[model samples]
Structure formats: C-alpha cells, structure tokens
Target: MNLTQKAMLGVSAVAMATALAGCGQTTTYPRTAPPTDSQCRDWEWDSKNGVYRCDDSSSSYYRNYYYGNSYYSSRSALQKSSSYSAYKSSITSKTSSGFGKGSSIGGG
Candidate 1:
C-alpha cells in the first residue's frame, strides 16, 4: 500500500487498540472493616418459653440458660455478627474504591 495509507492504518490500529485496552481494566476497592455494633445488635432474640426467655424488660438476657443452649446462642450471635460485618465491609470497600480520587491502577 502507499505510505500515506499505511500511516493512516497504523494510526487507526493504535486508536482501536487503545480503546479496546480500556475494557480490560482491573476494578478495585479500598479495604474496610464492617459495622460492629449496629448491625449485630438488631438480631431478634428467641423469646419462646422452651429454649430462651427474657430475664427482664432489658433485651439482652435469656432464660433456660443451659450450657449447650448458651453455646449455641453465642455461636449464632457471632455468626450473624460476622456476616453483617462482612457485608458492611464489602459495601464500604466498594464505595471507597469508586470515590477514591487519588487511587488509580498505575502510579501517575
């Protein structure tokens, strides 16, 4: 082909390459911890007379406090807390990654 035609093709190829390269970028998010108190505390305690009982109007206490039941309760609470924490952490990380103006893939 002619030199002028070859140069135009080279320029067009470079532009296309650059445009396609943009589609393969790595998406990232900032590391963040989840919400501790607010998320975990919202779980409703089992109020049935069989396993758990409310000691008083205060929501924390439960009755029929046996060893196995206590263990189960603690484990359940921890699992719920951790799940909520993880969810919150992910959301925070995504938000930070999206809005972090200074953060970029390559160091400028």
Candidate 2:
C-alpha cells in the first residue's frame, strides 16, 4: 500500500477505536439500599436545615422517598428525632392531594 493510503487508514482505525470505546460507557450512581448510619450520602441531593434528601432526578431513579417527596438521606440531627418523619408526611400529604383531573393545562 502507498504511504498516503497507509496514513489515512491509521487515522481511520484510531477514530473507530475511540468511538467504539465510548459505546459501552455507562453512567452509574453508587447508591444501594438505605444508609444505616444517621448521616450518609450516596448520590447528589439537596439539604436544608438538618434535612437532606435526593433531588428530583435521583428521587425517581432510586425510589428514595419519604411519604410522597423524595428523601434519600437526612443529617444526624434530624435522624435523632421523629420530627423529620412527621415533617415529611405533612409535606407529602399536602402535595400529593393537590392533583385534580383538570390540573393539566392542555386540552384536546
């Protein structure tokens, strides 16, 4: 084969190799089962006061929920008491019951 053709083939092979390497790549979150300790984190989340919980995407993906809202984790302070559970229940009850058939904005 000519040098020019050989160089082109080399470039094409390198490109194909890189492309194939990326095909099997998968993103994985390392959270598994509920944390045993009062304070632990496995995935990205949001926290306020002493309350910690998974964000929107993580909530649906991991099924980490308390009441109706997604709660992946909580700080030691919240875990030390029952108040957090009560708070979660209140928030979930209110939000979940807010839905109605006409809630959807669009109509056919």
Candidate 3:
C-alpha cells in the first residue's frame, strides 16, 4: 500500500505483538499438609458414643479422621485455613482469542 498505510500496519503489528506477549502465567499452591500431632490436644466429643471412641490415645488431630471428623485443629484454625475446602468447586472460566471480535468471515 502507500507509505502512511505501510507505517500504520507496521506500528499496529508491533502493538499487537507487544499486547499478546504478556505472559500467560499460572500458579497452583497444592493443599497444605493435614494438621500435625503437636497441634492436637485429646479428642472431640461425640453426642452418642462420647469422645475418644476411635482410639483412646488418638490425639485431636487423629480423632478428626474418625467419628468427630474435625478437619482443623481448632475453631480459629478452621476459619483461617486456606485449603479447608468444604464444598466441591462448581466454577468455570473461558478464554477467547480472535482477530478482534467474533464475526462471520468472508460474508456480505
């Protein structure tokens, strides 16, 4: 094309390249380790069978694996835990790339 048009195309190509060059970064922090033994006390209480029914020596940390099922060490810890996922994740995302917008190609 003409000189001006050529320069514009070059500039546009540069701009587009710069824009698309942005990194597609992805990071994932795997679920943290389960509560440790030092974080335990005794065990939790069960309404029907009472506490320490799983293992008498089982600490609070181990008791959670049984009837009590207290995942976290303490109340505040449960609230503060980042990996304490209560429900299944039902979320989703979509990424769309195109010349500009989604439109019919080579049409009237």
Candidate 4:
C-alpha cells in the first residue's frame, strides 16, 4: 500500500479500537455483608393460626441478598441501595473490567 493509505488505515484502526473499547462493559457490585439493623425480626410460630410469620422479614432478607449481588452496565449507572452506608461502601468497593480495556481497574 502507498504511504498515505497505510497511515490512514492505522489511524482508522486505532479509532475503531478506541470506540469499541467500552462496549459490553459492566460494573460489578460484589456481594457484601448486609447492614445490621436491630429492627429486623426473625420468624416466629403463630400457634393460634398455625402459621409462621415475622413481619415480612423473610422478604427483606431475600431482597437484600439479591440486591447486594448485583451488576450494572457502567460505573455511572444508577443503582438502588438499601441504605446510605451500603451505597457509600459500594462506591469504593466496586470493580469494573471489560474487553479491550487495560487490566488496571477504575483506570478510565
């Protein structure tokens, strides 16, 4: 190829690579310990009704578990957090990695 044509091809290749680098990227908010709350309750037997219940504690447990181990498309994406502490902690603990990006995480 001619010198001019080769230079153009190199530049185009670099531009293409840069454009696709962030594609398919995902940010991981790994599973972390649930926040401690004294209000949370445990299951209790209702002998009169013959059914076990504890103010929907079971529902909250599963919700927290699943929400804690969630992922986002990018670091800037919005997320639903259980509490301010969890949100703040995740800010520093989250990790992001993807194809075409360097191994150094959070490098941007």
Error of 4 at 28 (Å): 11
RMSD of each: 15.4, 17.2, 14.7, 13.4
Winner of 2 and 3 under lDDT: 2
- lDDT, each prediction: 0.39, 0.41, 0.37, 0.41
lDDT of 4: 0.41
TM-scores of all predicted structures: 0.26, 0.27, 0.23, 0.27
The sequence of per-residue lDDT tens digits that candidate 4 reaches over residues 1-108 is: 999999999997776675465454444333334434433344433332222233344544321222223422222331333453465455433433433453333334
User: Which pairs clash in the backbone of model 3?
Assistant: none
Q: Give the TM-score of candidate 3.
A: 0.23
Worst 10 residues of 2 by lDDT: 99-108
Q: Candidate 4, TM-score vs. the true structure?
A: 0.27
lDDT of 3 by residue, 40-77 (tens): 55444433322222233544445443222445434445
Candidate 4 worst ten-residue window by lDDT: 63-72
Point out where model 3 deviates above 4 Å. 25-108
Q: Which candidate should be chosen as best, given lDDT against the real structure?
A: 2
